[model samples]
Target: MARTASLSGFPEWLPQERVVEQHVLDTLRRVFELHGFGSIETRAVETVGQLLRKGEIDKEVYGLSRLQDDDDSAAKSDPNALALHFDLTVPFARYVVENAGYLAFPFRRYQMQKVWRGERPQEGRAREFTQADIDVVGDGELPFRYDVEIVLVIAEALSALPIPEFRLRVNNRKLSEGFYRGIGLEDTAGVLRSIDKLEKIGAEKVAELLRTELGATQEQAEAALKLATIQTTDTSFVEQVRALGVEHPLLEEGLTELEQVVAAASSRAPGKVVADLSIARGLDYYTGTVVETVLVGHEQLGSICSGGRYESLASKGSKTFPGVGLSIGVTRLVSRILSQEFATASRSVPTAVLVTLNDEDSWSAAQDVAAQLRARGISTEVAAKADKFGKQIKFADRRGIPFVWFTDAEGAHQVKDIRSGEQVAADPAVWTPAEEDLRPQVIARVAAEV
Candidate 1:
C-alpha cells in the first residue's frame, strides 16, 4: 500500500513549539544587536570550487546542477551548476570578498538562515536545519580580544534562552596545533578530527584508529585520547593536563586566554562556561579559540553551539580577512528542547483579548472593543463566529488566550482572565493589563543551567 508522504529533509511543529523557536531566535538577535553587530544574509549557493576549498565539507553539500547540464550525464558533472549551502561561514567569507569595497573593517554581522546537508538523518541530526551565526571580519589581523567578545555574547545568548542546562566547552587551535607538533605528529588535523569522534566512538577503537589510520604510535595515540577525554567543569582541567609535563609554549598561552574568557563570562553567569582541552572543533580552519556547548542532562544530544577563530578566511585587494565568531545550531538546540518537552510558550496568534461576538447585531460593538484595545497596544481579535456565548468562551480557552472580552446589549464591555476563569466589568479605554500580564513567557527555567 502507498503510505502517507511525509515532508522530507524539512521538519516543522505546532504553533506553541514555533513560539519557542521564535523566542530563541529573538534572544539571539537582541544579544547580537546589543553588542553592535549589524545583520546580513547571503545567497545560498557558491561555485563548486568555492564550496570545496577545504574538501572536508564537500560530502555535506546537496549540490545543484542545471537540468541541461545534467541531462546528458549526471554522474560526472560539477555539482555547482547550483548547490545548497552547507554552512553560513563560507558564504559570509565570500560575501565580504565580493563586497570588499562597501564593507567596513571588522565587519560585524549576525545571520539566521537555513543550511542543507545530504546526510542520513537520525535523532539529533537534520538534513535541513537553521543556524544563527555571528562573525566579526577585519580587513586583516583581528585582535585576539575579539575572541573574548565572541564567547561572552554566545554565553549571554544561550543564557537568555529558556533552557535548563548548557555549558560552553572552550579550547584553542593553537594549543592543539602546537601540542601535536610538539609530539612530532604532522597530521594533527586528522588526529583532531578523530578525537572529535571520541564521544561517538569509545576510547578503545579510537586508540586503534589513531595508531593505524592516523599513523600515531600507540603511546602517542593513548596520550591524544587522554587529552581528548580530559573534560572538567572548570579551567582547572587545563592545569591538570599541563601537569603531565607537556612542553608546548602555545599550550601555556592557550590556557591563559581561555582562563580570561571563563572569568569574563562567569561574572555574568557563573559556572555556565568551561575550558575543556578536548573540544577540537572538527573543522581544520579554526586558527585560534574554539567552542562546543552541551546541555547538562541531555549531554548525549551533543554540542548545540560551535565555532571558532579563523584569522585569514577572506582575501581581497592585498588584505586578508581575520575573523572570530560563533554559530548556534538553532535546529539542534530547538530540537533538543522540543524532544524533552522542555519549553512553554503563549499562543502563536497572540490574541491577548478575544472580543466576543454575542450575535450578528452586536458584532460591530465587539469590533469596536477590539479596535480600542488594539489601539492601546494590546493584541486583540474579534471572535469570528457568532456562536453561543459558551462556545465563544471555549474558543478562547482552546487557544490559551489569556483574556476574553464580552460586550452586552447595553454596550458595556467586560474582561475575563481565562486562566483564573474570572471576569470583571472594565473600560477598554481606561483599563490596562499589568505589564507582566501582557508579555509572553517561557516557563522560568533553572537560572543556573543544571
Candidate 2:
C-alpha cells in the first residue's frame, strides 16, 4: 500500500507555531516600513539564465517545465526556460533593470517571500523557505554611507525580533582581496573561495586546499588563516591589520571604509556590529562590505541573516546600479525559535471571548452579542453547541479563550474569566477585554523567565 508522509525540507507549522511566524513577519514589516522602505514582491519564477547570472548558484536552481512537455521539445520551443528563484537578490537585480524607466533612483524596498533551493536540508536549512530582504539600489555611484545604513537598519530589525542576542559580523571584500594580493597571492578570488570553506573543511584542510589548489606556499596559507582569525568589536581591528605589515592601496581603502562603518555602527547600535576580518561571503558580486549574523550561544545554526554591497550586479545599457542589501532567513529564524521554545503565542486562535449559548433558543442572542463584540474590534466567537454550560465552558477552555460570556432570563450579560472564575456584568455593545488579552499575543519565553 502507498503511504503518505511529509516531505522533509518543506516545513509546515501547527496553528500556534504559525501564530509565532506571523508575529515575526509582522514585526519585520513594521520595522522595514518605519525606516521608509517601500515594499515590492518580484515574480516567483525567473528565467534559468537570469537565476544563474551570478554563476555560483546553478546547482541550487530549481528548473521548471510543463508536465506535458518533453525535454527535447521544451528546450527547442522555449530558449529561456523558467526556474524558481533561489534567492531574492538576483530577481531584485532583474526587476531593477526591467523597470529602470519608471522607478526613482536610489530606491529602497523590502521583500518578504518564499524561495526554493535544491540543496541538502539540515537542522536550520530548508529547501523551501522564506527570506525577508531589504535593499537600497542606486542609479550609479551609491555612497559608502548607505553600507553603514544597511547595517543600522538590519541591527534595528534583529533587535526588535524575539530571538537571542546577535552579532553582525562585518567584513570588506576589498580588504580580503587586497590583503591576499599584498601577501603575493595572485588569485584573490581563488583564495577567497578556499577561505570560505574554512569553517566547513577545518583550518588544516583549508590550508591544504590553498597550497595545492591555489598554488599558495605554506606561509601564504598561514597568513590567510591569520587574516581570517582577526575579529574585533571595535575599530581597533584597523590597527591590528596595519600591524600585519601587508600594504596595498585597495587594502588601505577597504580598511578606511570598514572603519567608518564600524565607527558609525558602534555609535548608533553599540555592541551589535563587529568587525570580523574573516567573513568572506562566497558570492562573486559582493565587491565591498559583506556581513553575516549569528545568534549568541546558538552558533551551530549558522548565519540567520546575511548580505552585502554589489557594485555592478544590476546594469542597464551603460548605467550601473550599485546596491547594498541585507536578508533575514525567516524560516531558519522561526525554526530555531520553535525548536528551542524561545517564544510562543498566548493562544492558538485569535478569539478573546467565546459567547456561550445558554439554551437552544438563546443561540440568536449569543450571536448578536458576538457580532457586537466583533464590531467593536474585539475578537469574539459564538459557541458551536448549546449542549451544557459545562460543555460550552470546556469548548472555550480547549481553545484557550479567556472569557466565556453568558446571558440571563432578564437578558443581562456576564462574562467570566475562566482562569479566575470571576464573572462580572458586561455590556456587549461596549465591553472590551483587557488590552493585553484582546488578541493572540506572542510572548518571549525569556521575558517570562525574567
Candidate No. with top lDDT: 2
TM-score of every prediction relative to native: 0.90, 0.95
Per-residue alpha-carbon lDDT of candidate 1 for residues 1-450, written as tens digits (9 for 90 to 100): 112218655667677777778878888899899999999998987776777665386667777765665363443255445677888998898898989799888789999999898877755678888999999988867888888889888888888777876898988877776677667777878888877777787888878888889788988887777677666666667677786566778767777777777777667667878877778877777888999988998888877889998866677767789888898989888877776667766555666888888788777778887778889888888888899988888998887778888878787878999789888999989777777567566553445221
Candidate 2's C-alpha runs over 4 A off are 1-5, 72-79, 447-450
Pairs with backbone N, CA or C atoms under 3 Å apart (clashes), candidate 1 = 64-82, 106-138
lDDT of each: 0.79, 0.89
- Per-candidate clashes come to 2, 0
**Residue 450 displacement in candidate 2 (angstroms):** 13
Give the residue spans of candidate 1 off by over 4 A: 1-5, 65-69, 72-80, 232-242, 246-256, 263-269, 448-450
lDDT of 2 by residue, 162-276 (tens): 8888999999999998999999998988888898888889999999999999999999999999999999989999989988899999999899999999999999999899999
